[model samples]
Target chain A: MRTTKVLIVDDEVEFASTLSERLSLRKYDAKAVYCAEDAFAIARSNPPDVVLLDLKIPGMEGTEIGKIIKQFNPAIQIILLTGESENKIISENLGKDISDYIVKPVEIGELTKKIDNAMKEKEKLDHSKGQP
Target chain B: MRIWKKLMVGFGVYVTLAAIIGIFAYVELRTITKRFTVVEVADDITNIILEVRRFEKNFLLYKDDDTFQEIKKYLAVLTDDTDKIRKEIIKEVGTDNYEMMKNAIAEYDFQINILSKNFKLQKEFISKIGVLTRSIEKNLSGDVLNSFLIVRKYEKNLMIYRDKDIYATLINTLNSPKFATAEVNRYRSLINGLFKLYREEQSSIEKIRSKARNIQTFTEDLSKRERANITTILSRSAILLLFAVLTIIILGTAVNIKIANSIATPLKQLEGITKKIATADFSKRIDVRGKDELASLGTAFNQMQDQLQNTMRFLELANEKLRESRAQLVETEKLATLGRFSAGVAHEINNPLAIINEKAGLMKDYIDMSEDFPNKEKFNVMLNAIFDSVRRCSSITHRILGFARKTDITPEAINLNSLVNEVLKFLEKEILYKSIRLELELSEALPVIKSDKIQLQQVFLNIIKNAADAVEEGGLIRISTGIKNNTTFQVSVEDNGYGIPKEMLKNIFEPFFTTKEKGKGTGLGLSISYGIIKKLGGNILVKSEQNKGTTFTVEIPV
Candidate 1:
């Protein structure tokens, strides 16, 4: 099986670090950053297979970051992770090529399941794009 | 009835009294004037006395039959005048003086009659002497007869003159020696008889004059007394008039004051009550005690005051209720703000908890895959505890998000039983852990209702969760669903637990009204559910009895 490249963007350093480490142990290539700028930088250099984004970031809004990510790489799957269920932000980004959303304090098992679903949906989209 | 009429009536009473007094005074004045008329009769008596004296003098001078008849008429007139005066005096001054005057007039009349008879005798004597002298004339010498004629002339003069000196001169002449003794003796005899009669007649005339004077004096005194009596009467009448006027004034004033007080006292009381009402003290009432207009007004005023007081009390109660409702609204607003705020905070906390949960899972995996690991079981248990707490926290944050999410309804055709089942699935574990028996009595072939699925799900979830919380171990919660006349779906959640107190049941759905302990309840569950159900055009009802159980019934249109 090919390793999944996962990108994490959050302003909370410990949360970003711990989440990235947990994802890496789960046998995926996960990288974490604390701001939207770094997230964009990492995404443009080495495009991720799936992106995990926090609804609240330091400088830029979560929905704007999401738009930027999809614009940069349309094939990259994005999943939203939020400390609070800011329904406005979640629903706004849901239309912007977001694959799924999960309220925070999510169990690892559940997060893994969502990640697998997101990767599958991305592959299907890629296949369809390649056919046309 | 009206204040003006009352006062006018009071004044009218005084005017009537004054008119009465005026009439009495007029009558008294007339009586005094009438008595004065009787006093004027005194003037008639004095005039009669003067006329009687004048006629007497005329009779003495003329010595004719006409004079004599006129003198008699004068005397009768004098007597009549005296009698009239006496009668007047008796009428006015009582009978005591009338009798005295009557005696005086009678004596005067007697004296006048005597005087008249004596005059006649004297006349006869004079005529007889004349005849005797003529018979003796032829028997005397010429010179003696002449002397005799001279003496006779003197005697006639003396008789007419009625003078004593003249009579004496005539006697002396007749007694002279120059005359014959027989001739003198004859004349002297005749003279002696005439002298005696003349003296008696003179005395009687004097007596008549004296009696007339006495009557005149008495009449004058009687007239004076009558004048005095009239004066006395006039003064007394004036005094009585003054007294009557004074009595009328005093009595009128007293009555006027009484009438004014009767009217004014009630008016002042009404004014006082009005002032109290103006100041917002509506309890004061007029205490009038009689059945006049003022009393009736007081009764009406008291009725008005009672109504005003009742209205004021109603207003106060309404204001109190309004304030309580306003307080409730403020609490609802605070809860809304807190719901949003806590949702945000919960989301923020969820991120870190997720991180911890993931890290702990990663550690557990690492320990399980490693060849040699120290304290593996202890690490596994600790990591499991971390996972467990994180999962618990996630449940709480998710539930908070459930309520905080915008409740804008998205309607869909949904089966009521399926919806209720979906909501109960969330609380299945809690029910098992508490050992509570759950029963579902969902009716078969229930039609799908058109409503918001997520909102109804939340409503059912809240009610079922409250039921779970209310029950003890082995308690039963029965959830039933039904189709009501093919138009609506109804769901009832009943729990056999310690029931809600009757007093608090009414307020249970009000914001922040809670029965649970602090930290166990935000008290927003039922309140939010009620609001959502209401917004969805549904109804929720509750029935509970103390120490028995509670039932919440929800109905939504199909």
Candidate 2:
């Protein structure tokens, strides 16, 4: 079985590192980036199968970065983590091919479930494209 | 009396006085006209007497038939005139002289008739004597002729004499004898007969003249008396006219002044009151008296004054309330600005809280994985405590963010009792720390409603916190939930604490109105809860009394 590659992007260093370690323990290849620039650079160099994006970052908007990452590789699944519970930001990026949106202080289990579902959905799409 | 009635009375008095004066003048003039008749009667008497005298003179001078006829005509006229005058005197001047004048007139008329008869007889005697003298001239001698001449001379003397002395001398001469006894006796008889007739004629003429003179005198005396009466009447009428003019002027002026004073005095008072009212002295009122229009106006003005005073006080109270509300609005504006600022800061707080939560959870997971490392129990306890502390910190931050957040919540079907329990979870620690006994009477069959869950949660949380704050240590707080009606649900939070004063009850829900000390309360809890309930098509109501308990009820549609 191929290990699922995951990228965690957040302005909160401890949150992204801890969450990445937890994902690694759960038998997945996960890495953490602290800023939008690092996230973009790492995503272009090593495009992960799934990306966890923080909606609030210092340099660039999460939606903007998500759009750029999707353009770089349409197969990359982007999920947004936000401190805001506003549905407008989520609905605005519905057509941007984002995987899902989650509010802050969300359960680790719930986030993992979303990430696993997004990877599976991408795999299914890739397999279908590979089919007739 | 009414104004018109007063004016009518005034005019009535004036008209009555004028009528009285007019009646007096008319009566006096009438009396004067009646007295004037005496002068006219006297004038007629004077004219009749003159006619009688002229006719008598003519009769004596001519001894003609025409003269006698004139004398008879004049006598008849004089008699009629005197009789008419006497009747007029009887009617006007009373009967004192009327009877005397009537007798005099009757005697005078009889005497004039006899005088006329005697004059005729004298003419006849003269004719007879002429014949006798011619017979003697033809037959007798010188002595008889002398005797006849003496008789003729006496006869001529008797015819001419009207004076009593002349008449007596003539009569004596006639009686003297100068010839034979028989002849002398015959001549004497003739002369005496003629003489007797002449004396009677003279006496009758004298009586007629004397009576005419008496009539003239009586008429003159009556004229004098009647003239005096007329004069008196005319003068009295003139005086009465003057008196009437003066009386009319005095009475009219006096009555008019009385009426004017009655009207003008009250009117001036009313005008003064009205002026005071116009100058904004609404406290002044008019004194009403009588049943007149001015009195009615005074009553109306007094009512107006009361209304004006009441309206001014009402406006002043309303203005004060408006100013208070305006101040509250300014506080609301300040709260809005504070909400925006807190929202901006909430973002910074969330990132750190999330980091802390994740790191603590990771530490707990790592400890659980290496369960047998040195001091594993203490490490697990420390890790769990850290995780719990992080959870507590996140919860507090999340609540603050929720309060400041302007996020629009999608509506969803929610159970009210469950939402109330969820909000109570935040106050559980405070309830325990304060030693308050909480009672929940949530209805199990309470209907679900479509509303914003976050806002409802905020509303319940605010009400429960307010309830908790109101209770002392070991105080009781009771929360009851039930279906209010067919399509509404209600939640009531009650606390046994020092309740709001009666005077402050109305302002309890106003923004920035709080019983808590400054810096301990932002005063936005109940106000925000009220706003939230209203936004969900609901309302928040409060009931409180001093020294008792307070209850806040929230009603929302199902």
Best by DockQ: 2
lDDT of 1 by residue, B111-160 (tens): 66776777777778778777777777767767877887788788878777
lDDT: worst 10-residue window of model 1 chain B: B34-43
- Give the per-residue lDDT of model 2 (tens digit) for B1-558: 789988998998799988998888788877777666657767767676677678767766666668677766766675676566565577665786777777777787687667767778877877876776676556666875676566566556655664456556655654555444554555556666787887787678788778878877877777787787788878878887898899889988899899888888888988887888788777556778888887887788788888888998899999987986676566555555666676667667777878777777787777777748888898778876766665555554554455556434469999888898899899889999999998999888876788898888878888888878887899999999998658778999999988888898887766668888754565666766765665565778889876578899998877
Report the lDDT tens digits of candidate 1 across residue range A1-132.
468889998887887788888888889899999999898998899988889988778778777788898888798899988765557667765846777887777667888888888888778878898999
DockQ for candidate 2, C-alpha atoms? 0.40
TM-score for candidate 2: 0.61
**lDDT for residue B164 in candidate 2, whole number 0-100:** 56
Candidate 2: fraction of native contacts reproduced: 0.48
Per-candidate TM equals: 0.57, 0.61
- Candidate 2 residue B204 Cα shift, in angstroms, is 4.1
Candidate 2: residue B227 lDDT (0-100):
85
User: Could you tell me the lDDT of residue B288 within candidate 1?
Assistant: 69
Q: Name the Cα RMSD for model 1.
A: 11.4
- At residue A41, give the lDDT of candidate 1: 92
Clashing pairs in 1: A83-B347, A83-B348, A84-B347, A84-B348, A105-B350
Cα displacement (Å) at residue B168, model 1 = 36
Residue B199's lDDT in candidate 2: 71
lDDT (Cα, 0-100) at B483 in candidate 2: 84
